[model samples]
Target: MGPTGTGKSDLGVALARELDGEVVNADSMQFYRGMDIGTAKLAPEERGGVAHHLLDVLEVTEEASVALYQEQARAAIDAVLARGRVPILVGGSGLYVRAALDRLEFPGTDPRARAEIEEDLARRGRSALLAELREVDPESAERVADDRRLVRALEVHRITGRPFTSFMPRREYVRPAVQIGLGGPRGALNERLARRVDRMVERGLPEEVARLDAVGLRRGRTASRALGYRQFLEVLDGLSTVEAAAEATTTATRRLAKRQVTWFSADPRVEWTDFREPPEEQLRRALRRIAEAG
Candidate 1:
């Protein structure tokens, strides 16, 4: 897996073709229908006859849960393995990728407890909750900078009496698998991401967002906040210009790429290849790594 525009999708398809594998999408945004252009979703014809799973499975209005995704993706992987085809999990969503492959357990949600915590969060604000989290799960509180995540950590701690980081992914994979990471320098990735954003707008990202608006994309907590879509939605609402939106999208995407890099880099087991490497070489390296891993 790699940052956006780092050519992970192309590599995934190439590797799948070589290994007789089906592709499993781990990108969160690609889960929605009609989010194609904005998400840079590969067209069916572009998939090279390699069956792809877990794309277009969710409505734009629905919230995406990593726990639910874990179950569905694992089942897909099992089915692919049963058919004697490898399953290539591909995406820049580090958490979803980890959820699918790592032996990570999600804490059960408590609506009543969650409602209460959310109410407290709204009233007391993040500073107060962050202070409490520091008292309980200091590690997670320190690592998680957002108010939403801080609330979840505190809620999980209150419900389970365990540190929030307890649910964090370990390096070990639950299945026999190999993780290949694509790496590039920060400056190069930023330039690539800027060009990609420009390409997305030229490819009708604004029109795609307009179409999805009828399907309740704005109501989707997760979908609405997606990188390019949100900025373009503002463009539609007359709150921003196409130029401003594209610039915002580029900036946000660069930040996202940095985060994805940091997240995947933490896993010592990942075999990384430079993004500048030839595709055929990377494919041979991935195959070799998989064989060695086996």
Candidate 2:
């Protein structure tokens, strides 16, 4: 897995075909049912007849929980293995990917505690919560950028009496696995992302957003905030033009790609291939790496 528009979907299909494997999605945004075009979700024909799990399992209004995703993704992988086929986990969501493959533990949440933190957040604001987090968990204070995450960190600290950072996934894999990362130069990726956003708009991202909005897209805490969907939703509200939304989506997607690159690059186990290389060469390198890993 790597950045958006880096051809991870095509690579996953090719690898699944070669290894007789099924694909398990680790992308958080792809979980929603009606978020197709904006998410660049592969159509059924594009999956190359490979069975895919954990896509379109949630409604637009449902909040995505990484803990639930971890359970479902591991079950999908286990089922693939039990059927005598390999499991190819593919997506750009770094934390979800780690939750699927790493030995990460998710602490249970306390709604009462969370509500109290939310109250504090509303009354004292993010800076005050951040200052409090610094006292108990400085690493999470430095890392968390939003109120939702900040509240969750404090809630976890209160309940578990452990730093939120303590729950971070270890580098150790829970099972035998191989990660193949595809990326190219920043300039090329930026151009690709712009082109991709343009294609999405051309393919009717606004209309897609309109349809989901009719079915409560804005009510979704997570799905509504997705890159292109968020921008296009502004178009539905007449707050922005399609052209402006496309531009915003491109900018946001480029930033997301940068973060994805940084996140995946930190993992030593990933064997990266240049997206500028020939598809055949990339596939060969990936297969060789998998063999070496075995």
Candidate 3:
């Protein structure tokens, strides 16, 4: 696992090929159908004949639930293990990755309280609710930069009568496995992301968004918020130009990469290697670490 555009997907396929494993996607955006180009999902030919599970399992209009994802992803991993093939969980969605591998439990949601919070958010604005969250759960408030996540944090605190950070993941894994992180400096990652966004635009991200918009992409609470997709949707709506959308997408993607790095780096168990390392060297190191871990 690693930040976006850090070659995690390519390395995942390579590792699966070497170990006779299957790839189980942990990226939240890749879960939705018709979001291929924007999410950088690998085409079938690009998969190098390694079977992948949990990609394209959701409609663009559907919401993604980490709790549900935990159930399905774990089942897929268990099946792969039972068949004597390794399961390589891949992607940079840190929470989804943790939900699939860690001993983490999602707190039950209270719709009534959540709706009330939503009302408050619409009425009093995110700053008001965020101030309240700061008083109750400052750690979560600091960590969650978005209003939507802040709202959820406030809702969780209200319902469970607990600090939102109480649900922060522990370092313990729920299964016997090794986590390999692709690490590089921040400047390098930002440059990579800018190039990636440029490639996405050249590859018809705007056209893809137009197609998805006709299919109810706007209704998807999760899919609608995807980085490039959201920005390009504004382009289609005449709210922004292609250049503006590209700029926004690149900026948002860089921020996401930083968050992913922070989230994965906090876990002491993850074995990290330089992103610039040769794939052969990285693979050998990963295999050695897995052997040692076992």
Candidate 4:
């Protein structure tokens, strides 16, 4: 996986064509309908006749959690395998991607309690919520990186009525695929990200966001949280000029790319490729690795 606009979708498309495979989207944003451009979703012609699953499958009003994504993606991958072609999983959502390929098991949820916890979250942002979770479940907080994960921990604890620290016995998962990273030194990647932001604006990302609002995907839900969309929404609300929004998009995108770089660097399974490498070369190396696995 790579950062947004790091050519992940294009590489996935090219690789799917090369392998004669179906594309299963691992992107969290692309799952929402009417979010086409900002999520960098492939157009009909761009897909090159390859069947793409899990794109535009839900209304933007719907917010997908990792567990839901895993469930659907698993089904789609099985369908692709049944067709006797490779299933190419593509996107920058590391959590959904890894959850699908590695079969990680996040604990179950209790709906009523989840609602309560989410209410609590609204009242107190991640820090206070995390502090609360930490007081009750220090070990889980220690294991997970941040408060963004407190929601998951609280869900598990509230559902199971058990200490969140006791999740280790549930770590059984069978990995199904190889993972890799894309991009290079920070300076080079930032340049590429800026150019990508420019191109996205040129392609009318602002119009795309307005169209989503037309389709009643107006709320700042999960889909709207995709990089360029919300910035454009600010422009829609007259909170910022288009130029300001574009600059903010580029800045936010840079920070996201940096986080992605750090995430990939820490991931042992992800062999990386520099942005300078041709996509075909990266595809060839990946295919070779898969073949060797056989």
Best by TM-score: 2
Per-residue lDDT of 155-274 in model 2, one digit per residue for the tens? 999999999999987988999889999998999989988998989888988899999999999999999999988998888878999999999999999999999999999998889899
Candidate 4 per-residue C-alpha lDDT over 26-103 given as tens digits, one digit per residue, 9 for 90 to 100: 888888877776677889899888889999888877878888888888999999989999888888877787777773
Candidate 2, number of clashes: 0
Which pairs of residues collide in model 3? none
lDDT assessment of candidate 4: 0.78
Q: What TM-score would you give candidate 1 relative to the actual structure?
A: 0.88
Q: Which numbered prediction scores highest in lDDT against the true structure?
A: 2
Alpha-carbon RMSD to native, per candidate: 2.9, 2.8, 4.0, 4.1
What residue pairs are clashing in model 1? none
Q: What C-alpha lDDT does candidate 1 achieve relative to the native structure?
A: 0.91
Candidate 2, lDDT over the whole model: 0.93
**Tens digit of per-residue lDDT, candidate 3, span 1-294:** 988988888889999999999999999999999999999999999999999999999999999999999999999999999999999999999989999998887888888999999999999997898889989998898888887798789989998999988987777889887999998999988998899999999999999999999999999999999999999999998999999999999999999998889888988888998888898888888888888988
Worst 10 residues of 3 by lDDT: 168-177
Error of 3 at 241 (Å): 1.6
Model 1, runs deviating above 4 Å: 115-163
Each model's C-alpha lDDT?
0.91, 0.93, 0.92, 0.78
